[model samples]
Target: MTLDVALSHRFKDFALDVAFEAPAGVTVLFGRSGSGKTTVANALAGLLRPQSGRASINGTVLFDTAAGVWLPPHLRRVGYVFQEGRLFPHLTVRRNLLYGRWFARGAADGASFERVVRLLGLEHLLARRPGALSGGEKQRVALGRALLSRPQLLLMDEPLAALDEARKAEILPYLERIRDQTEVPILYVSHSVAEVARLATTVVALDRGRVVRAGPAAAVLSDPEAVPTLGVREAGAMLVGRVVRHHPDGLTEVALSAGPIFMPRLEVEPGVSLRIRIEAKDVIVARGRPEGLSALNILPAEVATVRRGAGGGVIVQFRAGQDLLLARVTRRSADALELIPGAACHLVMKSVAVAQADIGEVAQAD
Candidate 1:
């Protein structure tokens, strides 16, 4: 359940040097474009060779320059889902998926075609061609094709980059299913903060081809110092909660460490756990529990750290119960409230501010 990576390569202008260990869940290579995120993915997939590096999955060495261990692409047994589907337009979906079997080096090790199709919800569209499918469907097919190959590790290079917001929304749940239901580890690349918030169990932050931050998703994302590189407004907190109940008036109540949180109704049953992403910009810091506020969520918290941003804003890290919450507030507002380390306050936000795409349901075990 461990994937280790260390790569160093010299390019014309950019150089890639990174080392990190990704656990069993989805590990994201997160950064802006041209930050060597894809280079790492490519190195892992055997598409590009690093001048010096070592990669291993579950103790199986994929490449190690010092050891002269260089397994070719086919021998790597890594599944790749590119930005485009890359499916054969001439072939039906079923045939395209079956094409992955041609590269199977061994018995596929119990990864059958039926199980993959069922997992990806590709049953109905199996008879169609790539040209007739939607962007989301095409990507799902691509994922299935990769899964059918029975990869030791899955490499996804911005698989959702080609999709619109709607399309991304449609396919995210399926990817979540893969992350929770499957045993194979995933190396996913993305620049979207929303996607990283929802999909990443481990995050490797890259900047100018350097590994700036690499750790659990909660620890890396909650640090205000890292927000400047990730984008100030995009900084946020990921909170775990369980569905309490669905009200008849169209609001869903989720019990968090802070307290009960009310949000726009989610179409899910009670007792379901979720990871809720609340943007730092969306949180309002209140000096005390105030009245007459229209915001639906008011959580009592203690300020832990306040880091000034590049602009007029400041990133306020606070503790709400056992969870850490981040708020982006103007310096003037922070001064007005005299916010500082260990200051007691309350965080506020409207229920509707939580977009559907920002919430990820935790898949239950079998």
Candidate 2:
């Protein structure tokens, strides 16, 4: 296994008993505010020792309480990025980045100084202090510093939660580059469904310190039962598609398993395969194919299941070829349209509604 984790910890009213295995790519710990996502991450990084359990990555044991084996944070060779940049205000950006080199273990820092600077687009700000850069830029510097240490695994805890929308947008692409280009695996933590859908190869869902679900991003995100827990508005399906063509009218054609889907123009070049997260609320269900609709996407699908919301709505699951899509509607609409399991229906989606933040690599959203 690329990563193995199984532990039990207790603190006041909360008890965390979670077990999961995440491969070499990005694995996310996703859930609500107090779900122990951060706790799991900290434990893995050796920042928080678990009462009893074992954690190993690529055959190296980081911790084993029963066996009395525990590696210190520095020896664990794990890099951490916190919610805030936490860069040294007194040090120049270049020096801040170089500081990480001191803790680098046996390996020649896997990434070079110039390469790290270029990867994060931090060359221009190299002479400045932490106080001089924007929130996004500061985070980028923090990330560069962490990367310079040449860690075997990376742990990021809500790195974008403190940024505004525009700042968040600015830092996303750099993260995507890190996810795609680097060999190091990432163990990220976040509560946002949109974040999980875009960045995670595998998702471990937690609730009040307990792991509720764990699987590939596409499978876990499309599950109707997992939607409510993730958040009704954030619940959705993730589809992996490639950019076939770009239209002059601000739209990009994505060839998916079901059919060609057209969405707002993306910044990626043709032939780039990207993951798009379609929110359940944004999807509409029609008993039959509708004509003259403003929505550009209308794919034929068969109803797979119908679920009731905690309030007063119905959540419908549709199978579009190999991909699954979801639509949220009122109970009255289901009855009026006679929507049932295995019923043929058309799923309509609007192009403009798809958030750019929800597209591209997993790290972009997380």
Candidate that would win on lDDT: 1
lDDT of 2 at 162: 96
Would you give me the overall lDDT of model 1?
A: 0.90
What is residue 255's positional error in candidate 1, in angstroms? Answer: 0.5
Off by over 4 Å in 2: 361-366
- TM-scores of all predicted structures: 0.97, 0.95
- In angstroms, the error of model 2 at 364 is 16
- lDDT by residue (tens digit), candidate 2, 63-92: 999899999988888999999999999999
In model 2, the worst 10-residue window by lDDT is 357-366
Candidate 1 segments whose C-alpha is farther than 4 A from its true place: 108-110, 364-366
On residues 1-366, what C-alpha lDDT tens digit does candidate 1 reach at each position?
899999999899999899999988999999989999999999988999899999998899989999999999988889999999999999999999999877775754736889889989999999999999999999999999998888889999999999999999999999998898788789999998889888899999999999999888877888887896687769998888899999998999999998998998999899999989999989998887989988889999999999996679889999999888899889999999999998999999899999999999886531
Highest TM-score, which number?
Answer: 1
Q: lDDT of all the models against the reference?
A: 0.90, 0.87
